[model samples]
Target chain A: MVTTVNLTALRRDIASLSERNALEAQAPRSAFGFGDRSIDKVLGKGLQRGALHEVFAAQMHDAGAATGFVIALALRSSSDQSPIVWLEEDFAAQEHGFPYAPGLNHLGLDPQRLVIVRCSSPQDVLKAASDSLGIRGTGAVIIAPWSNPKCLDLTATRKLLLTAQQTGVPAFLLRLGAIPIDNSAVTRWMIRSNASRSSGANAPGHPVFDATLIRNRQGMTGHWILQWESDNHVFRQIEPVSGAVVSTPAHRPPQTRKSATG
Target chain B: MRLTALDERAAKAGLFKTMALTDARAQFENLDIAFASPRKDAALLEKLADWCDRYTPLVALDGADGLMLDITGCVHLFGDEHQLRRDIHQRLSQHGVVVRSAITGNAAAAHAFARHSAGDVIEDSALTQKLRRLRLVSLEIEDVHLAGLKRAGLRTIGDVEVLPRAALAARFGAGLVERLDALFGYAHHPISPRCVVPACMVERRMAEPLIVMDSVERVLHALGDELFRQLQQRVEGAREVEASFFRVDGEVRRIGIQAGRPLTDTKTLFRLLKERLSTLAEPLDAGYGFDIIRLAAVRAERTQTIQKSLDSTVQETEEIGGLIDRLSIRLGTGRVLRPHPVDTHIPERAVSLEPAVHTAANPPVEWAPVQHPGEPPERPVRLFQPPEQIETTAGIPDGAPAQFVWRRVRHTIVLAEGPERIAPEWWREHAGALTRDYYRLEDNRGHRFWVFREGLYERGQTTPRWYLHGLFA
Candidate 1:
């Protein structure tokens, strides 16, 4: 009787596991991959479409990097050439400068495909986000609020997520100088600027991001150092130089030992 | 000071306008007097003219105190001319305003009759005979001209009419003949309405005023349907639409919306109007309720009749257009913007944010590519307007900054690229302008910034100042 009971317990576990798998299969599986092998592996199939994703600047000064990362994601996730709507708050635009069209063109985004909705406040940003997310043919929606506002509560984000899911348009909430809080986003990311590999003459090269996946509802969290290849419109993993000589550490061994002792 | 005007009691006491205030007070010891403000009177007259729009769309201000309403073809709606005149008089009286109204075949005759002989509705055949009884002063001519006519012994319009036309023209000037002909209904003088007459309009007049918001929306929907049908019959669409609400208390409220494209769909039109009404800064006040609601296409354009296509792209375009219109109406048109490439080389002026509604109608602009293959972007992702000044320490007088202080934060420059010099446009009148040497800099913390040095290190000028212009990703 003990053997039979153990066998039944094992069968029940298998049954539940299979059921979960089946449910996951039935869920909307339309996703867009990041094209990077390792990042895509960590993201299962890739970032799910028609869901809410939050991107936070790791530091207040890294807002430019965070914005670039979000733009890359939007370009990757958009299924077609449909227009992308950007909901920007007035405070945010004043704090960080306005998005430049020539820069957007340099980043492989057509200026004509961008629709900017300048909202007066954080509340208006969320309102416009929800409106754009409900639109069927919209490529993507990026909601950039200045900072953590009281109106950006869990309830508001949940509403945005539900609307995005219903309309199959992905929504990205970009926060500058804000900490990650509990919300209904499918994925949460913290992004910071990474030192780009220098080209000839010690000049800064392509834009590089140190992106940390803080939360993922359906997959494992990971980190990456990504270099945006604007010409090809893809994110490439930053590879170490093949035959570069290593330089000495800036801090000497005696100084490091004294600090450690303290 | 002279008294500019008088009330009925003061007028009955033999006090005339332009009489000295002391004389008026002497005529009546316990006189009630208030200062007359012609400016305020003119403002009230303008408001009264707006209120009169409920009767006819053509309402113009006559002088400072009178309103000229051309009620042609509108009288039948209010039963007849006599009833229309009585209704206007009764309604205005209810508002505590004493109004004198007259209907005539022409505006000049009507103006004379209303001021000199109140409550006269003259037919086309009787306009001349009726106008002849009015005094020449009622013509509203210049004071000098009126004195000339009086010196010529023309006491009434009858005396002026009996004179020869050539003699009258030669003696008093051609203006008198023109005025006489206008009064006799021999010439037509159309009144310039204060508001633009709509290209097409449909209105609903209710016996009971509508106080509920839902009822107003329902009426708007029906009106939209009617308007769409009218537009469809003419193969036209509305570019600009206006909905006017006539309140029972003589308050006229109008809400206008502009479409990015020629809109022919009734549902989209209703949705846009509803969105605009809901987002109004001052919510619609239904004070005493609205008695008449009219929908008009102020600007209509001829549109091609296109067959419904099976292509999904066409349908998607239509849906997106509708969405743009809805958003523009909700959040003001200026808030909804798209990047428009300008023809200048100045970074800030390179891309201008234009209202999306207008830019959508324009052909897409060709943006010059500023990126180079296998290299980082030449331009920064975000550009600050009027670049912020920064303190910097440079190794050389003209070299890129070695370190910079921005926003009270010190950043050590690790790598930098440029000294791409941009000279100011000398063709334009920009005084005290200097050349700019820009550099792309990455700080030790990996934050990238675009900084510039204004003015070169020349011999006879102030030291060049450093400024942080943009942020790069």
Candidate 2:
């Protein structure tokens, strides 16, 4: 006599699975405004707001330029009432002399709101960033680990990204090299300076940038070929590249798993 | 000596009659006056005190035509007490002050004899007979007692000392009796100084004054070492150190440094002093170079040494601090700052930056709640020093513009997500007159935008423009 499995037990197992699925569906999806439109669509609407959004700028290895860009971005995102926390590593080049404060102020950003923590080493910077995540009134935290030797490590970076994700304030890391660490970050992008024709006599030129979302969540990975108008400091899609516009694949969230070690 | 004769001449004049005359220099704008007593010719006592400093730091006015010095440990350096007193009198006479010389077993007798006799060294054998010969005025009695003694026809100190002590007290009052006894060495008469001498002080009497900064620094280092050795005698570290330069002329410049903690290390103390000296707008100039360099400890405290770790990282931090100190010294204190956290919702008020002074303490930081714990307002990535106005066509009759021009560029909105109204902070009068309706709008060209409505629709103000404050990365 062959015994058959009980119908109620199978049904109960199915019910538990369904309940778990329902709970997972109810969990709020992390979202942040890309502060751009097309990029937001590709990025699942802004960087997961309150989540860690890491962009690995491989070609943009220049820390100063990257620092300037981050400063501009942080200034753009901050308000007079709430400011961004900048944890700086050992990037003490002569050019880095206290100019960031006044420069940010000149560009329609409040200089007083920028909290610059000058640490001796990158480890200290990461520690300060991790510490900043637990602090309220801190809208965004910009960390550059590669600039300081002590902070240039795998462990601290992972810990920092984890803290950023948990707290929701975006942590922008300036990528030092070409190969992106996909697992350690939610989003990894490579920003290459693309050339554009000068529009008019006085207007310097059109800034065209080729930013590839090399790694993305939700299967939305592709390149964003855009024109960066220098005057406005904005990026607009000129035309989508062939592999640039990949839609989210149905049935599961896209996983571009990257290792903790880069 | 030359000064003793001058003092004898001044003693005949009775110039320095009272303690009041000793401090008379403080009232005068110029202290370089020849002392002249209206009562007598004893105008040389003041000059004598000024000249005596050349001999030692300790000097005081004793009586009319007289100056007293302990000279206990110092006299031996000048060969003997007689030689030291002789040298002192000679120096005084050179500067035109009359002074009398007297040495005795005690200060009171010496003071009395100095005022009355010439070169009197009263031994124990002749003490009583010598006291009887002195006048009542030399007894340092009060005015009433002197008048009483003169009325009673006992006008001499000898007459007063020969009388019974009980009868003297009964007739002339106790003050008269006591002052007589004090003057006759029957009671103690302790002398107090104007300024107490520091326990440890080192002075460099430069034969040739130092004019160069490097030389001055070298002198300072040597002086600091000497001062440190003096401090070491008492097992105390200097909390406050002062370097004083006395020019050839009458100008004195003092640079002082007070440490956060008591420090005895010469190099560290020198470095701190260097920072302070660098910040001085006017460099101290020694016209003919500093003739006298003195390092004095104004305040001292017990110092406990902490065993320093041999860790290289700790050393590096110290090095960085030193570098910052140098930079801060070069820049104005207001220009170089350390960001300190402030407890406030407003970003501008959240952190206060201050100069990197060694004594400045780390301010209290409200570290908990790493979230949007304070005011949950939307902050800009870039904050304008002054919020710039963006011209937007969003507030037209139709409301929410399909296309708005910012920085003179036309970008059409593909999808817009807010009129998230952020009213101006009502309490602040300086907040601009704009009720922002912030919208995270994407342009038709796929550029994400941060645009805000400056005013309301069909309300008080017309032409509501949108500001482009920041861009998304």
Candidate 3:
């Protein structure tokens, strides 16, 4: 049966409908690789866009792994039309001589499309992140130094999520060290070095390492290992480690507690 | 010959509102004033205009309801500026017009006086006295903010003048008192004129007013031609041109045009101006006919004095630039852009976008390491801002992906190559210190992908999660 709606009533209904439609709009989500395919599959088509994806180090010294993971993801995910915005917190580019430049280029990202904004203070980084969300055609924005607890406050996280949803751009946060695992993020996991292999008759043979996927948002965690080819600038996965190494100290760390799920 | 005796009864009766209100209207009334109420407008304005003409010839419209005059050098023409001002005011009063005239050392002071305090004429010697007598508010001072002064019993400018400025600043805001001092001329008060005064301007006063649009257009074209001739004689080319039409009904119509390359061609100038005018919603109307039409060269740029070359090739480049300029004006400035290279290792950071004309052709940055598309990169077609975390249970940790689920779908890894193991840039001090375990895993469905874990092996560590960074497809 056709319902006869009044003009004013219909207008009010339309207004509410639009409001509701906006409120109920599906939040944008994205998926980026850790340069690992098995892990990407379980991540629900990668990372969620228009949301904050966080990575924490096992310890402060292991920060290189997280950074490497982020740079690879940023380069791999970015398209020719849309670029990445890397937000730095008190990071001196000249002093480090563009640490991620070579890796990012090797990963097939155009260096010019990447706009790096150096922020001395957390306030600046947060403000810049919010502003970047409004820029059209920006694929993703990476906010590093996710360590400051204040950086990921509820207000900022919600804003980041809303911005990503609104614009369909992804945002990533890299913290200094492992934070208290909470369900603020859509997924969680831990990474560790693969068992080192004895190779090369020389001093420094090809570096062979393995990684463990300790957590997942929607699937079971497992272990993957590969060797880095310095000459080709690529990684080639090797055979699975023998059963002895599965529980050995090389791949598994001692008694790490699982992250609390939401 | 006749003796007059003062009689109290014959003297003017006590002032009444009706009797005190002058029937004579002002020359220029404020915008807020009533437009119609049995008041004479034209005759009163004519008398004022005549009186103002005696002061300067460059008088023009001011605000929505005001008049501005350029008294440069001409002030000396009328018996020392003071006498000239007094005579002008006396003439205005004789015509039953109330006027306020100010004769200052400069045009700004004169204008400020005419607008703010239109009373008695101020002489240079008694300028301070007149300024002191004027209310502080007249100098744009906030009255409610005089609390500190009230406590100190400082009532007037004269009172404040006696106290040390340093002491006064301590008691009150320094900026506030400094402004007051500047206004009073204790310090220099440099004034910037509202509009840039044209160095060379030409006006054509018609013998008879014109009402037809064709006639106005003819005058404009003629004026443009004449200005171009003058420019040619002086070896100058205008970058911007403005044509102004002043109507008898006080309506002004202005048409402005800009040139890509400075030129003084009347045909091109008219074409541009006509095109601009066509876009106007309201056409230029000479309500009561126009009395004057002026064509001015607002800005100019130098041109080479090269001999006229028969080279058609030379003209083409200039023509193209002109075309781009016109097209840009019609469309928008940022419609066309050029890509320039920047120094960065990240692929996306390689190029910057800028306006084609403004950008330098040379790349701004240089990088040694560059990867070509020919090289197989494990780069995903779509990359996430941050890698997504995933759960996995598969083969040994030291090998290719055995099996995993992404986006709620499970995939058994068949062919996978990675553990690229990109380390964190330690110097950046990123918040999420991650040790990523990156891998390129292919599912049984023939689709390959990249994924990584955010952080390295450790328990009780908060940061780091497994994330699917990007897709190969």
For every model in order, what is the iRMS?
Answer: 3.2, 13.5, 13.6
Output the number of the TM-score-best candidate.
Answer: 1
Error of 2 at A94 (Å): 33
What TM value does model 3 have? 0.38
Residue-level lDDT tens digits of model 1 in B256-334: 9999888897878878887998898898898899999999999898886767887677676666777778888888899
Q: Judging by TM-score, tell me the better candidate of 1 and 2.
A: 1
Q: Can you give the TM-score per candidate against the true fold?
A: 0.90, 0.40, 0.38
Looking at model 1, residue B80 earns an lDDT score of 93
C-alpha local distance difference test of each model: 0.84, 0.55, 0.54
For each model, chain A TM-score?
0.83, 0.66, 0.64
Q: How many clashes in each structure?
A: 0, 52, 94
**Which sections of candidate 1 miss by over 4 Å?**
A1-28, A240-262, B37-43, B158-189, B304-310, B361-363
- Docking verdict class for candidate 3: incorrect
Colliding pairs, model 1: none
Off by over 4 Å in 2: A1-262, B1-69, B98-111, B114-116, B119-132, B162-166, B184-190, B205-219, B230-235, B244-255, B272-292, B310-473
- Candidates 1 and 2 compared: the better one by lDDT is 1
Candidate 3 chain B: worst-modelled 10 consecutive residues by lDDT: B23-32
